[model samples]
Target: MVQKTFGIYTTTDTTAEEERLYVELGQRHIALWTAEETTRQILAFELFEHEMSPLDSLAEVLKQVKLFSRLLDNRYAKTQVIWENQECLLVPNSFHDREIAPNYLDLMFGNSVNTLVQEQQRPAEQMTAVFRIPRNWKDAAQQYFPGAAFEHKYLQLYYRFSNDPKGIYTLFYRSHFILILVKGFKVQLLQTFDYQTPEDALYHILNTCNQYKMDYDTTPVHVEGLIDLNSPMYEELKKYLRDVSTAEPSGEWQIGSEFAQHPPHYFLPFFKMMS
Candidate 1:
């Protein structure tokens, strides 16, 4: 196995009685960070390898989350986790309180056995965001934030990129994580795929576009995260999509100037605030 880097970013002299935390949990890695409760501002962030597989890593990931929160002096704060499992769906908001409310994910992913499902309503529109969280994740989330919202990563991302004009917004992030979002007032498609080569990644992009019947030459493709102006992925994307370009996190949170140590588009630190 190869050893990769772990990171923590923060600002000192915090004074909140209880901080707020946001998490993005997945098979490859986990990200946890504290956010200002009212302003939705990011206070600190941490990233570490979780070595995820199809098998569950809830125990290990939450352990790391607690360790990082303690390091930031917010071990028992109000928390919300964004499960990046990518097994998700977005249904009509009207169905949220109906019979399908609890079974929306089961209906989509077809896992019949009882699972804890969570819902986030998109107030700006009449859409409901529904998804499955492993029972393990539901338990840990209850321990962390008993009465608050627990969500899926794509749900939060959907709200962030929901304003895009009927096209694709992709995040080629760290650890082979690709978040492909197709939005037009509502999310038409949202999937996370892992790729090993430039060809492999582009194939998925083109395939998704073709499947959706979105014109790559006309529909703008906005790229972000680990990719850059000189990357093979960027160059290849430009070859197929007419309006390919770098994208950034949408928020008013303060980013430390020292974060300049990394690429400007690398906003893993700010992602937690999307929830």
Candidate 2:
């Protein structure tokens, strides 16, 4: 069963024509947000969680997408969809070649016949993100929101944290988490790992630090997404890292009281994309 895990609708007075829609499609979650363009205030936010069995067919996934799209207002002034998945990699612009983009993924993830390869260039960061999305999901997204822009989730993170100090930044999801190591304004590592327990998550973070020679005793670590301050993962991280904290929400956007229902850091990347 698909469940609306979290929702906050603050306004119905504004027409869809005056709002912008942002949808984040991930492995197990669908989050939608609407904002008033003029005021730049978020009007509504909804998060849905679903489980997909290995036996499920492509049609089943498309059906879930259709059901989730109902919460999206098709008449919005503009819409952008952010695709979040594990099949992506970032390459420095100097070494990036558009014609051979598929080869990069093929070498990293082996050949996949059922996916569409795409790329996004970040001129400022001097990097290009090459990613693959399942063709069925891509077709469904195109059908639901024709002409809408699409972006990989890591591109947003790179834009948000590329300028920050040298540290390890992690964003947790249901079964997987993304870890980024940045130093000297350059990304050293940007990868995702699947974990079944808090120990598994800690092992990956610490192992990455060791591999990169980052001193866990001194290097800062900022975590966000679905993790909580009191959760075992947070406590475990604090035990090993000297400086660990939850990433703060950007002060630019004016969030309403409705957003207060959840921890400010829960949707850090989602809100950062608004800017």
Candidate 3:
């Protein structure tokens, strides 16, 4: 049997050993790997520092994520889109049991597109594009939003960006939940919270569900991040959000993992204001 495999490399967590552990856990599904470079070093700044533009920042991050997805789809064993951020990842699957297919990713960053692309045998669009956004941002996310009205509009989303290399500290704002609409693609809604305690975050999330009138409390939602499951944040998140399913956090796409894998990889090119 040809067991499918995929890899993640990022710097969300500073721990190096956790990568191997995450990989081991993932081995039940897809074979995992990591890059020697840290994803933290790839910092993108706004086009101009003239004003505080959170929306612009969010758009920039989306672009970066989209570009990264493009690169991943351009090359890979499986022609599928991959999405990553400091907190989690989401992969599209053709099978009912999404985990069985190597169609999604966890956290990991910092390998050249050229290298990853070299491994691709198919063209883009043959695979589904992965889309992920801040779950905590849904809370207190009104500031970056634009209103959209649709009957049974079950979801919402917002986007923002910043120069802060420390992605977590940039404010997930779990107090509010917002929805994002893609022209002809998919829609995303997320909740953001301040406290590191997962219980607190989960409480806020539940509240949002009530407000949205969606039955999410018992739903098995998926999540991902780079922090060790044994850590305070991880434990808290699991306890409070236990009802939801979570993906293995991608260390390969995060800053901490990137640094652990490679401290000196050049990331200046990837982090830039696209014209």
Candidate 4:
């Protein structure tokens, strides 16, 4: 798999943000750029940075994004923003089996009604994903990007990959990793973990495999995101699996020439959003 060194990228460019649609907001870094509204293809994109903390208001991130995005034009005219936060919960859509509990997340996170919580139901998939954007963040989004869509990053990847997965699929982010186990379109497991070292990440994947009775030695694994093909994490994974390869974004939008420069997997969720 190839690794995209996103940290080397800049925040946002003024004239460029005007031409396209959709932005990825993660870790106080705003990927502000445009995709063709008709084609939903990425035209040009740029990343913007602002200092932030878990406790800092998300408005700080929005403030910096507004400083760059709303310079002389209004993105709200046609463009939309997609927020990618990690805090989320997924519940199967078996209403008869379990009562829907929206407040369950608030207690888990120790936030109250002040949190901006939203849920999307993929009834065809029998799952409802509830995700959170900090209140300050939601307020900021509503102000500048009223048409914004909020989803947990994991859910975005989950729906896209789970539709027709085989063996194991993993998505590696800079901060953590997510795993989804599927056998012939049947999802057996969905999970996430935080890791500081390569071994920590390995342990979670291997342990999950063992628990699910997956043959770690033979199950083909597909992966995407910030992992390097020769990195210790990838090498260690290769030792356990018979086949491992970097996965490409599965759906379609007319890909722009500018997108050719970035790893295709880096924009998997963004493409999924547009699709």
- lDDT of each candidate versus the true structure: 0.63, 0.81, 0.27, 0.63
lDDT of 4 at 164: 74
lDDT of 3 by residue, 1-275 (tens): 12221123443433342221101111011112322232323211111111212222333333333343312222122111112122222222332233432223232332222111101111222223232333322221222222311111011111121111211111121222112212212323332334546565556656655664545544444333233335565466456544543333233343444234422222211111110
Pairs that collide, model 4: 11-47, 11-48, 20-34, 20-35, 21-34, 21-35
Q: Quote the lDDT for 45 in model 2.
A: 81
Name the better of 2 and 3 by TM-score: 2
Per-residue lDDT for 1-275 in model 1, tens only? Answer: 21234464556445554567666666566666666656655566666565645446466566655664443344534666666766677776655665656565556667644456666676776777666666776676566556665666665676666666676767765546555555556577777777877777788888988888877788777776666678787788787778877666455565565466766566642463454
The RMSD of every model to the true structure, in order and in angstroms, is 3.6, 2.2, 18.6, 5.1
Q: Indicate the worst ten consecutive residues by lDDT in candidate 4.
A: 1-10
Candidate 2 error regions (>4 Å)? 53-62, 65-70
Question: After superposing candidate 1, which stretches have Cα over 4 Å from the reference?
Answer: 1-6, 36-41, 64-77, 95-114, 144-148, 175-186, 249-251, 268-272
Top candidate by lDDT = 2
Please provide, for model 2 over 1-275, each residue's C-alpha lDDT reduced to its tens digit, 9 standing for 90 to 100: 56776678784478778888888877777778888887878878877777853223434654665565545635887888898887898888999988998999999989887788889887988889999987777777787777788889888788777887799989888788989999888777888899989899999999998998988888899899898889888898888888999998667776788888788888775777774
How do all the candidates rank in terms of lDDT, highest first?
Answer: 2, 1, 4, 3
Q: What C-alpha lDDT, on a 0 to 100 scale, does residue 180 get in candidate 4? A: 77
Please rank every candidate by TM-score, starting with the best.
2, 1, 4, 3
Q: Is candidate 3 or candidate 4 better by lDDT?
A: 4
Q: What TM-score against the true fold does each predicted structure earn?
A: 0.79, 0.92, 0.27, 0.77
Worst 10 residues of 3 by lDDT: 21-30
Clashes of each: 1, 0, 66, 6
